[model samples]
Target chain A: MDIIVTELTKSFAGHIVLDRFSAAFPEGEITCVMGPSGGGKTTFLHILMGLMSPDSGTIKGVPSRKSAVFQEDRLCESFSALTNVRMVLDKSFDCGEIQAHLDEIGLGKDRTKPVGEYSGGMKRRVALVRAVLADSRILFLDEPLKGLDDQTKGHVIDYLKKHFNERTVIMVTHDKEEVDAFDARLVTLG
Target chain B: MISTMFRKSRLEKAGAVFLALAIWQIGALLLDRSIILVTPVAVAQRLFTLLPESDFTHAIAFSFFRIVGGYFLALLVGSVLAVGAGHYHGLEMILWPYIHAIKSVPVASFIILCLIWLSSDSLSVFIAFLMVLPIVYTNMLQGIKSTDEKLLEMAEVFRMSRLRKLKYIHLPHLKPYLLSACSVSIGLSWKAGIAAEVIGIPDGSIGEKLYEAKVYLSSADLFAWTAVIVLISVVFEKLFLRGLKMFFDRLERS
Candidate 1:
């Protein structure tokens, strides 16, 4: 099923963000949303993820199970990267399986260390790993690779593409390289 | 360098206390009166005698249990209420007036009014609870309010379970606020609780011992009981805060 946004309108105070914006996010495909700063790119994603409601709009086909990597890493600083991931996963998830997912992102060795101690790139990978590994119908990535160096970014992008396969991934970013890397369909907002 | 500075501070504190004690001894000697201002030695001696007395021990036990019990109860209730209000703005609005009233109203007034309503024996508990509630509630609410919205949004999108959200996000955020509130309110609870006892003259309470000391004009007994109260309050605060820190440490690790 496709997630459909119809004439989505949102305003903060008196500033218009999204003005009757319409778009289609097809099932099992990556849709990369791009825009200038304060262009409602993040707002649109937030609405799609049900974290925020559009002022006037109808959204359809958004699944109940959703996951996201916010613009900020948003990892629990005091907790281990593994523990932060485990908070979202069900108890039925095996520790070995979770470790394997972390290992895919080259974070297996320090999964037990507090994410507070993790470097910027390492933290981004942890957030990405957490989002991809969770059981979700749609994965929202808000600049998930924003702060990473080129080498780490390429590595994580590969791992992300592998795991995000055949899943509805809606990513918001300003990077055209990331869009081309994922071969994602682009939706520009103003 | 930090450890050396810490050691230096500790030594300075000890020297200051010693100097203050010496000044107090000289003042007492000049006055030549135990009834007015007794020497620290006299107070210490009185403490040793009181420690062996059944009445003194019983009073300590009585006041200790009620006051500490009241503080814990307030902590529990305040935290629950703060969490509730954090989730529901309407609930916070409803609780606003009462919280403000508790904060503004004089403790002595509450003690008197409560004495009319409650029995003398339970006066300290209620007073302590009343004193500590607003402090805990306000600080905890501030903590809950200041929790990172970005993290909360991530939690929401991931459909994180409530228990997990609390354990991973909320508890960590609340740690500093809870520690700060506990440190501050514990002493207030003790002071307010003992004051209530003093006014209510609850039998077998430290307050009653103080009252007796006052009536007999025994400054030594009065000073001794006062010192005992300070010691108990400080010790309890240290132990409770340490336990709270340990709990947070274990939570972060687990």
Candidate 2:
């Protein structure tokens, strides 16, 4: 089912962030939400992810099983990259499979080191890998490639495209190049 | 390389200890009064003579069990209460006054009051538990309170189960706080527990030996028992903390 948002409005401390905002995120398609900072892009993603409630409006069709690469890395800092990926996988996905996925993302050498010790780009990669590898009907990514270098970003985008081909994916970013690279349906918020 | 490093550290520690002993021996000789201060040699001789006595062994075992028991109980109860308080604001509010009361009250006063209500044998356990509970509770609560809100938000987004969130997120976040609390509380439990024993003078306890030493004016026995308490306390603290770290390591690996 497609995720439908109708008249969704939200505010923080009397400042309106989202006002009667509505959009439909298509199923099995990559959708990108773009807007200036504080234009309610992150708020919209948060509302859909059930992290925040709208002041007045309705969101429908969001799947129950969801995964996300948050605005922050949100990787378990004390755990290794492999362990962080393995944490979200179902029992059927063994450690070897998780290691393979991390290796594909260019994290093969740093798989054993805790993510806390990793560079920002490396941690971002781990977070992206975790979101894509988890079993989820809907995947949400907020600035998923923020700290990555251009070369690493291209590789991550390719990996995401290959793996998330069939899942409903919603991404929030300010970069037009990222949106173009993912070939995503575009939604702009003022 | 590792063994060499270990040997170097061991030698350094031994040299420091020897220097301390030399200072103590010099001080004792200058003081020239066994009543005020006993020499380390005298204390060691006293300890050797007392080593074969059944009472000596019994005293060591008795105090060790009560103090360590109180510490373990406090650890379990404090963590449970802190978790409850973390989950419920109302519960935290209710616990505020009790925790404050325990923290502010004097240890000696508590020992005396507890002796009236509890058997002398159990007084050390109660006192030790009382001293340790608030410390562990406060630290663990602070840890729970300071957990990353963003990570919790991520957990919600992923629809992770409660157990997974705890094992993967909460426990790992709380680790430093728990380890720190254990480090501080282990020594405190022994000190406060033994202080209570000394006051209550429980039968077949280190406190009783100390009391006998005082009554009979045997400074050697007093120094010997004091050394024994210090040694046992250090050994137990090292062992308990090691065990805690090992348990966490296994949890992380699994």
**lDDT winner among the candidates?**
1
Every model's DockQ = 0.85, 0.68
Error of 2 at A113 (Å): 1.3
**Distance from true position, residue B171, model 1, in Å?**
1.7
Chain A TM-scores of all predicted models? 0.97, 0.97
Per-prediction TM-score to the true structure, in the order listed = 0.94, 0.96
lDDT: worst 10-residue window of model 2 chain B:
B245-254
Pairs of residues at least 3 apart in sequence or in different chains that clash in candidate 1: none
Candidate 1 CAPRI-style tier: high
Per model, state how many residue pairs clash. 0, 0
DockQ: which candidate is best?
1
Candidate 2 reference-contact recovery? 0.56
Q: Judged by TM-score, which candidate is best?
A: 2
